[model samples]
Target chain A: MTFEKWMRESLDRVETALEHFLPGTDIAPAKLHDAMRYAALGGGKRVRPLLCHAAGELTGASAHAVETASAALEMIHVYSLVHDDMPAMDDDALRRGKPTVHVQYDEATALLVGDALQSQAFIALTTAGNGLNDAQQAALVRELALASGSIGMAGGQAIDLESVGRKLSRPELETMHRKKTGALLRASVRMGALAGATPDAAALKALDDYSAAVGLAFQVVDDILDVIADSATLGKTAGKDAKDDKPTYVSIIGLDASRELAAQLSRDAHAALEPFGARAQRLAELADLVVNRVH
Target chain B: MTFEKWMRESLDRVETALEHFLPGTDIAPAKLHDAMRYAALGGGKRVRPLLCHAAGELTGASAHAVETASAALEMIHVYSLVHDDMPAMDDDALRRGKPTVHVQYDEATALLVGDALQSQAFIALTTAGNGLNDAQQAALVRELALASGSIGMAGGQAIDLESVGRKLSRPELETMHRKKTGALLRASVRMGALAGATPDAAALKALDDYSAAVGLAFQVVDDILDVIADSATLGKTAGKDAKDDKPTYVSIIGLDASRELAAQLSRDAHAALEPFGARAQRLAELADLVVNRVH
Candidate 1:
């Protein structure tokens, strides 16, 4: 299939799966469920789900397994964003061209929404008939928890909060982004691969390498976009990182070098999938998309 | 063993397991880790863990399995408390006779701490060497997720938030407490039973009955203590429920009826354990303790 067709189909699958997995708004505590659906349903690029599906193709995972894994991955991503936009965190008002959960619902509802979403992510994974065996289900749950917990996304966020108005070395910034975003991105690939057949050590390593490169490339492009894109284009506030005095690649190493780094990382991601040959076509395409997408 | 000695030993076991399962404070984003530790350690009755251990006895589960499950359950309980005590929620400054997480660290750190602790709860279940098979592990994860998610603890919390200053019927109050706190308490018994040998349907039903009664009794006693105890004795602010105009058994049914309800629930809990004979000794004691404890 063409890349555009594949991306569209994958997004459709993820959206449908998320709808099925999430509690209905008519459920009790309807307001919290409403906010959760609002935050998770229509938003952002769904890049993590795309990566999960793409990586699953190489590992011969069933479509059902990949679909379920991707939905769970996306839920975690969306929950993080909901929490990040809260007043206690980034204090943002806009996300995905709409008011953030905290602004749309009250802060208390938003907190419950984020908390519930995180729990739902695990529920999605452990729900029976997801095409994963018991071991795979347990492994995926562990992978997600570790990737999003103190040593990963949340820890990275804590670092970001502490780094405001302070200078961070390039290495420090990279480390933060690796934990903040790269951890979950890498887990998407790993989980997809694990969903069907277990990948051998070399295969796992290759996929990890591809994910690490693409993940970093994705962040670099985000930094570049923050400087060049408008709020309308980005679907959220633009240039806020620099305005907040938070260090970014463009701020620390200049815009030109950051773009070059993104290009290099994209190339690295493609090279890492070389062993898989034509079977990795989708993964290669996704790497390019991460690097070259306008927003 | 005497109930006191058993309770003491179980508390020690849970504390050590939690210490091992939680990330070290020296880890990156040290402040968040510190806050997580502060919220999770050194306080509360550890009632959920005690219930887990007691239930595990009836099913012949390994000590290691029960211990790990208890830690995960306690982590979930503690995270809920951390989030519940936030300014946006209860606006409480004290917990466990010390400053709450948001007060001890910053609001951002406390939020991250709660998020990380939730993740860590799942990690504790899926971690290797936890004496559970993959199927058992997956089952436990599902139990925790379902009990804590939108339709469970978080959902109950949302209802509580919306019901402030409103009159709720007795059944409405019962339903709220069942979800907010009862779900996890029941999960504690179920998970402990599953962690060892899968209980037969009859045994599962009996355990559920026992847990349900005790869980309600626990909440009723909490309301009683809120009215009668001081902050020094309760390790938290007293009478805040009535002061905040939140519905409670004491406010709705009056103190005499509430105490009678708790006593009846305690009797029901003991009756549910008759099927297990002497095997349910700890569970019976726990039921009495839940209904009768002063603080």
Candidate 2:
């Protein structure tokens, strides 16, 4: 199948699983339920889910396990977006071409939605991992928890909040993104691979390298798009990061250097995946898709 | 040893475990880390941890497993307080005789602190539960997630938020508390029991009944205390629920009836523990502790 066709099919599967996992709008706390669905259900590129499925292909993980893990990863991603767009955070009014959760609902609902979405994500992790044994399933939960917890995504966010408008050395900025974004991205691959079969340490490390590079590349491209693309194209307010005085690759490094860095990371990702040869074609394509968006 | 002594010792043990688990203030994102430790390390009666230890005694579960699970439960409880105290929620400024997290730091820090504390709780669950096998460990996570997620604690909070200024029937209010406070309280017993060993279906059901009754009684006493106690005694803003127009047992059924209900619930809790004999003596004491506070 063409990459587009595969992506469309994968996105549909993710949406269906997410809908199945989230509480219904008519539930007792109707407003909160509505906000959870609003934050998760409708839109976005499903990039993290796609990455998960692609990596799952390497271990020949069962489709059921891949799909559920994908949904859980996407749930975490969406929850972060909802929280990030809150008035105290980025204060963005739009996401994926629609009103953000806090804007559409109230701030309290938005906060609760993000909080509930996170809990639901962990629940999803427990729901399925089709071929995994009990031990491996426990490992999956542990991996996701570590990635999302204080030293991972939330901690990275704390650093981001504290560092606003301050000059951060390149190493410091990279360290922040590695924990904030890199940890979850790496886990998606690890979870997918573990769902079917555990890889040796060396192979696991390679997958980690591949994921790390792709994750960083995706962020670098995002920074590029935020500056070059309009709000209509980005589906979010363009240049908001710079406007808010948040450091970005484009600002810390020049636009030319940022673009070069994204390309270098894409190359690194492909180099890490080289051992898998034909098995890694989709991963390579994803790296290209993440980096070549500007072209 | 006496139940009171055991309770005090257990509280101390829980405090130590929490101190070990929470990130240090010297960590890079110092403010967020400090807030998490502040919210969790000190204050409160450690009621949930006490319940966990008491139930763990039934199966003779390892102290290690019970302590870790107890700490995780307390973390979840504390995170809820931190978030609930936010301006968008309860608008409280004091908790446990100190400024609330939002009051001490700022709203954004409070928000991140809550979010990070929750993630840390799940991480704590994964770290230990020493006696539990992989499958059982997975179950521990699932139980905690179900209790903390939407349709659980967060869901109950949403109901509380939306129902402010709105009168709810007794049954409606009971349902809310069952999810709000009751779910986690019940989970505390269940987790403590699960940690040491698994009980048969009948014993498990009895423990559930015991926990449910005790949990309800605890909340009933809280409502009474809100009206009768001073802020210094409660270590929180007293009577805020009524001032905010929120429904409570006292408001709906009158103070006299609320007292009667608490007593009846305490009796039910004792009855549920009859099968455990001396093994359940501490649990019976806990139920007494919860309701007797009202008197």
lDDT of 2 by residue, A69-100 (tens): 88888888888899888888778999999999
Q: Which candidate is the best by lDDT?
A: 1
In terms of docking quality, model 2 is medium
Top of the candidates by TM-score:
1
Worst 10 residues of 2 chain A by lDDT: A127-136
Where in model 2 is the C-alpha error above 4 Å?
A128-132, B128-131
Each model's TM-score, in the order given? Answer: 0.99, 0.97
Interface RMSD of 1: 0.6
> CA shift at A88, candidate 2, in angstroms?
1.5
lDDT of 2 by residue, B111-151 (tens): 88888888887787776445567876777788888899898
Per-candidate Cα lDDT values, in order, are 0.93, 0.86
